[model samples]
Target: MAAPYLPMSQEEMKKLKWDQCDFIIVSGDAYVDHPSFSGAIIGRVLENEGFRIGIISQPDWRNTKDFKKLGRPYLGWLITAGNIDSMVNHYTAAKKKRSNDAYTAGGKSGRRPDRATLVYAQRCREAYKEPPIIIGGIEASLRRFAHYDYWDDKVRRSILIDAKADLLVYGMGEKTIIALAHELQERRAREEKEQSFAIDLQGLCYVTDTVATLQPQEVITLPSYEEVKESKVAYAKAFRLQEQEQNPYNGKILLQQHQDLFLVQNRPSLPLTTKELDAIYALPFARQPHPSYANQGGVPALEEVEFSLAAQRGCFGGCSFCALTFHQGRIIQSRSDESLVEEAKELVQAPSFKGYIHDVGGPTANFRQQACKKQAKAGACRHRHCLFPEPCKNLEINHDHYLQLLRKLRQIKGVKKVFIRSGLRYDYLMADKKERRRRFLEEICQHHVSGQLKVAPEHASPKVLQYMGKPSIKVYEDFKKEYEETNRKLDKKQYLVPYLMSSHPGATLHEAIEMAEKIRDWKYMPEQVQDFIPTPGSLSTCIYYTGIEPRTMEPVTVPRTPKEKALQRALLQFRKPENYELVYQALCSAERQDLIGPGSKKLISPPMSQKFKNRKLFSDKEGRGKGKGKKRRH
Candidate 1:
């Protein structure tokens, strides 16, 4: 979740007594509301399969007493590799430097501190030393290998080497967790009868067999961190091989050296069915924030609703910088409007309800349903890649359903105002000139928009946008115009807050200057100028290093240095004289001699000499300069 959506205090936590957990699954993520709650869902799945379970709402894993309060599990503790490492991610920034696995920034990558795997492992070891601790999640799934730790700014081995967890379970945990629990309980009983009977903890790796045997678990040949740092592609391949084999925990075949980085070899991630999803929606949501925090500016403002709901899941848009397509796939699944309305109704009755429904959207909100029926009719297409190079051809462009849903939510009693705060694919919404669609948007704004709308254009340069697998700037302009015109007609003064990214791999200093010039023309200073973070499992990561798509094999020029990335980002907000000087100096240092003067067709730079180059951010040595002899006329 973004910083804007941080959780509230204790009092607010009380109003939303939404859950009466049978076995509190203490986790890093806020309970239930996380987009893809695979950890929580798997726990529930096991419970439904006749295993008892409860979730200990976010506990201070740093404290031993906290773990004790969780009490003894009816079965055992199921720890997980958090959905994403809690470390600050800059994968998007790395992608801006190269087109593939060729260049990774040294300082910006690593495992996040909030990752449940590390935090929970430490807590379990200290507090509940007896019941088994099982780890699984994104943190443990993808990087379960010897890889680099961006936070510490050094290369490190597998997570197991760091977390010291008893058992590291990988991939999905639905069937695996249930089996482990049953084995533990059964083993305890068998010991009483025979005094020597043991249980084999299947689908996991544990340090000790207190409930089973006294023998040591065998080891296997695993990739070293040095080997992985040398070649990420090879590491990905090595893990993929392990993932294909069955019986992940059978002796030495199991790779356990860096269990944290080791990709789970066996258990498959189970996709949820419609019924299963409905059950999740039906689960109680304790939407309360702590009260003391609320009064002392500790809770999220009243304008902020205690919880957010995901109306849909998965995105078909294969933006190179996004991980949704790889992790969740391009398929879009959704909850029915009836379910959403029910959830909204429940939200209103809460004691903390402010009457305003903050947001009801997910993964490009207006895409309340999947892509067109044509694609569904043909089944999953084998085109291998999206055609848009940005928004795939199969991306279903329909806002009619979404429009209806929003209108219904607004009509709910006690709901003061329903807003759509999630990112809206502006291009998708404006593709057709259908008067009905346009008018529907007009009405939605009149009813739902909270004075501002966020749409991501990413970059203005055609080449950069294309390289980013995004729609052209003209498409973004079209959407902006339509949005403005719609609001104008309704007398609603809301404005489109377009999201932009600087330092994408394809953007050159000149292109960046052009983007900066575009910002000046728009007369809008953005609140957040996003630096790209190229996360793992995204098409952009390959492009960040290789400068070409593996499938098409096209030639690309990646921006591969710190100075280039910094200059490009600064251009997005070049207002101060200092900013201009910094950008001008940066351009000169990069040997971009032609952009120094006031008469250039592009954005200009004031001249600075070689004496300033050593100064931080800007200096004379990197200053704008006249060409070696004469300025080349464009």
Candidate 2:
């Protein structure tokens, strides 16, 4: 049987024969004890180490009463914005408030405050002033230093300052948390004064007022917060340095001043070892939402990943629009095949377990291990990406290990089918010169794919793809050919669900139309198209805000106008009845009236009546540019 849920109330703690929780975890999400939730992982990890942990999920941030419900923690209070940044959770890419939060019970929104980590930490301070307030998870991790805040439209100081947090743990912080917990435990056991924080561990950062006193061997002091806030050039430079020091093996310390205090970030923690990864996964997670959520229709987020197996963590795909490199780092860390297979066995036995396993993959499914053997020692190159314009010569592009792991999963008695549902880097897969790619493709076609597979071919425009740090469209075309060939050989009718996006930084209406033309050739109507959201810490966001690429400090064309953005998005889903007006406006605005008539090259028919003449998200001058739609036969 699975272990009991961690105590959320004092009565439950009393049953555990505990006077107080050693750590009280305050999260913006409802307390779900699944590993997919950050609070659950940290709680379980702490529990495995014999720490008395309690949870206060989605507490009212209005006052300290709800924050004090769990009583004081013996070691510290763990504050997180939950599985996702609370702002992103509550708001849409268009800055409109969303009505429901998947991570919340009953799928409710407004349960947590904006900038949740800050509010939670402040509440903890009000509840009890003594113990440390440690903020983490994606929100705190990404904002450990001064970062661009899309909602506010300006750079904000490190979270530690705004939250008044004692220490900030960034990145995937399991190793750092464990080490810090042990240190805090020693002093508490001996009944000594709260010791000063010593944040030498990788994947950790803390605030300091004295920069000269710190060990300066490899410290990189960035432009001050004042500078970054006032100057775009300084902001871009700071971001570049922050992105470069993500490697654990060879990374240096980064410091950026805010007020008198400086945010000192140590190098990231090394990716967990296979043995360590196995042990963490082996922990007895109840693998379900807390029993309290049962009457409230349960946690909706659990439905997606509860039955799935996370075989690995981290990514090397290096998409500029992605934030994984900063948070999970570039090194790929996989659990042992034995560990995942064992998890599959337990997963099948769950009362809700069906015959199918949802997924057995991570950030990038095809990446099972490090991009290359040398990455562990030397770290990723400072200015280069493993896969971008093209796959690097040093990239190790074999999928044999992943194939073997999949076969092992497929052999599990209760599992009728195992699917590879995670996002994959097809370019990396195609770069494998060895015959291993063929065998792997064949295996995936015959056994792994669940009818259709999804891959991101973000755009068709070479200029936009380059700015987005994606490979050329030709790479996707070549892979599509190979995928079709494999399906033909296997006699399978599976299709590739190519994920397309619109209005990414550097995307114009021309690019959006180009992508629509490509989609038309496939004779598929996309049910949904992702609008490029400028989240914190991404190079794409930098371009969106400053109109300059952070790395190169070169000006970039950004689609910031709401009407234009909507038009670009509509272009991708031209078949939708609601989008017809927008598509027509966009084509006409671009002076491509030829694409509006009833012809082979047309995207939408001419106005059905005088009623269509008034639509105006676009005008004659809206999308005017030198380039018009170039007729091309595919």
Candidate 3:
């Protein structure tokens, strides 16, 4: 029989007729027992392995009272800053406090403290010092190495050191966590001290006192923490080295010095096989926020994913701004079609499932398979990208499996519509054979699209796009024309919504203005714009801090000041009245004052003055019609 939601309290544990939990997961988000949320997946996975699991979600960090709610676990404490990094969750790219946190029950802010993994780990230790604390999730995964912290504006040491965690798991940690669990269980069975367990597990990072025990040829030593903290050049070098060794097949152990101790990261865990992935997703999940949140409004993050299916995991698109390469890795790991169909049928049985499947893709919707055959045997190429400046000749671009899966999903009884809300790599699509590409686009426009399809073109400037690891703007233009033509053929009035970003590391005012002009030509006013945020563990963030692209070590322009960033962002939405001044300043700064005028080709209209305005415009037209007895047309 499937399990109920993992016990969140001692009373729930007692109700289940248990004296203690084998492990307690402490997270910074509300406990939503859904596969989409990490806490639930970890808890359910452990439960499947016959371990008693309890969760303490968004515990108050001010004291150990909440952390001690579950009492001491037999295994240890698993820590995470929820689905997202706590700092990123709390603040915007501009360092402004966010008004609502979707992870929290009531969409309220300030539920989790800053650097939540660190704080949560500290509290867990304070609550019970004997058991080991293992940290994972986006926060720990990205910050496992010494990294540039955007919030601090300086290099921070590896999170494992700061959090004082015994071990840190990186990437999608299903396989790694299971390994750790079994090891801990064996140690407990043998009555061994947790600290005495020598953990050299893959996809894990730990601090050791010496490298003398490690084989010299099996390890790659990175720059010391002091070196990276003191020099941008060293930081870039360190980032470059770490990125190169990410391949699980050929990757070696990574070691870095943090003052007196050595922070060691084992090679990444192997990607899960299709059968393994299917089994993991098939694990029992209640697929709802814990009922305790009934009054406070359930976790807002679960809404989008409640009825959706995560078709696959990982991306090989290699966008410089994306963190998937670090977290989920570049290799694609997908579940079997049978598993997905079964899950979709389950959704149909739900009372609130309104005949719609919200989404059916992972990081990149169209990426249903590995980039090439070589990836399966040898792992992803360390030095080159599958899709970047140009699609690699070895790249295998196909959408037949995805199309078949979608067809099956939409045909499911009571599932009226199946949508593809996740990002679609148009460049990869365009690289496909003409007939297949046409068929896929036609089917998408005819069946999948809900009206507007959202895609990320990111920027219009070639230089900026290159820095972003995105294809040329011409690629997007080609794809856009093809998309529109496909919709026209199907007699559907569907449109494309292009996602644009502003103030990326390599973008100057010139590039920003160029993008603004492209937006003008497209007659599209984006409601929301993405400002390039320097999140940890991304190539773009490395350039944002070092002022040099790590790959080439060439200096790149970086927009660091708030004023400059504001100007760049304003240019992306120059049509807005609120952006007038900033847009004007940007135009002047670029020496393109011609773009600021009353002409149709101009980006913004010149500022209006009372002296130049027509007097009749300000006249009381309403009063003139009312008082003079002139009737207004209805």
Candidate 4:
């Protein structure tokens, strides 16, 4: 009934009884028709509009052979670098090549090129130069501006220039893509070669040779590409200006010069209403990886999300390291409870249904509405965060709607458990009235948690927290205490897994040592410690490249070298035997040798081998004698 997964090949298209596809989507991910996959969602949305759509997933970029699989489309070609930025997907924070890609079949890597969007766009041009090329998704969205590229270690030009795409869609592109599709359809019917495609559409960017015709009042010009490329101060200023104009209601057009060409970005598209969001999720989705991938063990990325429900979209937490503000924007758009419950019924009927729904949430699971009433009309405040340095007094801290949705989901027939796996903004939760917060925590601990609830406190240093745009460690501590107390009353043996990070901007060795000390006091061994990766289009990445916080224009210490990053990361997990040497060195460097001894208060025990003992690892007079006048490494 749904044309069985959007005709990935000509044979499939023939089976659908369609002569030609209205649009073709090319993605770096394996074809997974689930709502969680962006390509699938776009394809289905187009199909729902009575337009025939085809998709080519993870095509061979070496030649035009694979790109020709879907043939040419009647409307245009939509290209994306899958769910992740291709560079981030291929490399680690240390720039080491990754061996596995969850979006690929059999968990293998190298299926897609390093910059998949750019590669795919070029191949599309090679195959058919007539069709208009459009680039979107996480890769193109974040790199839409001339910003930092960790892989290249330099500021790259806007992706629109590199990809040579006719139009670049930023943010969640459901509304923007639909509008473009209709406009293309109208142009095709008219046979109008003179009428150009609309460049004034919201959430779209285009390149032009001149800005002489543009109105000065409607456009705000950022520092030119050459200016930002040469000056860190100019780069910071450009990022600040871009962030300020992100609001859809009051935001103005942004223009940036690249050599002789100008990149014009229209204001963001408005957030979708509940009714609109509900219809999009309810669109007929096959809700699984294309049957072709069954033999290759399917796409690993879909495993966890197969039975999960997406209750909402967008986040307002404003973590500096996250690109949600750049992609999904700050306003929250949620689906109706009836829609979620109906989807749950369908999941229960699947043959692989396990009686458990793995997750039921969005970017921030508990965030189900706009931050405040004003956000609906005025859009999110441009210069301030809702719950960062401190929760705004006007911030609406309510979890009632989310609780109702979860309750309704758990009540569905044949459903065993409904877990909230998405990250919960504990600061926002803690800001709620005590009774409501307690009730929400109690319900989650009693019914939703699957033995462990993962919350991201990120770091413990106040300086790093401020740079990260996160609440103080005190907020996390209060939430942790309340959570433990709630589990105690419920007599559940659940634990809190705090997501920790290291080597973020503003984190010197001293701050790293401070975090290690806190971990020591809490007696928590972080199983995983994320070393900050400076992916494109995040405030933290901008600061990493410029050494200046865009918001304050103040310099911050950045852990850029491999040695410093390693030492800082080791400090978070000092208990690991493999990290003993690095932790000892960090302790000595931070003048925190007090933490490397054989006591319960110490973070790690002194090295047992003579090799480390013979080195002058400490600067203090007491440990100087142990080295026997050997030169100190520090």
TM-score of 2: 0.95
Ranking according to TM-score, highest score first: 4, 3, 2, 1
Range of the 10 consecutive residues with the lowest summed lDDT in candidate 4:
624-633
Q: Cα deviation of 599 in candidate 4 (Å)?
A: 1.5
lDDT of 4 at 4: 72
- Residue by residue across 336-368, what tens digits does model 2's lDDT show? 999999999998898888889999899988888
466-545: candidate 3 lDDT, tens digit per residue: 99999998999999999999988989999999999999988999999999999989988999999999999999999999
Give me the overall lDDT of model 1: 0.56
Worst 10 residues of 3 by lDDT: 625-634
* RMSD, candidate 4, Å: 3.9
The C-alpha RMSD in Å for every predicted model, in order, reads: 9.1, 3.8, 6.1, 3.9
Question: Candidate 2 — which residues are off by over 4 angstroms?
Answer: 1-3, 190-195, 609-615, 618-634
Candidate 2 overall Cα lDDT vs. reference? 0.85
Instruction: List, residue by residue over 70-166, the lDDT tens digit for candidate 1.
Output: 3565445666544454443223444322221111111222212344567777886677565555566656644444544433434455565567654
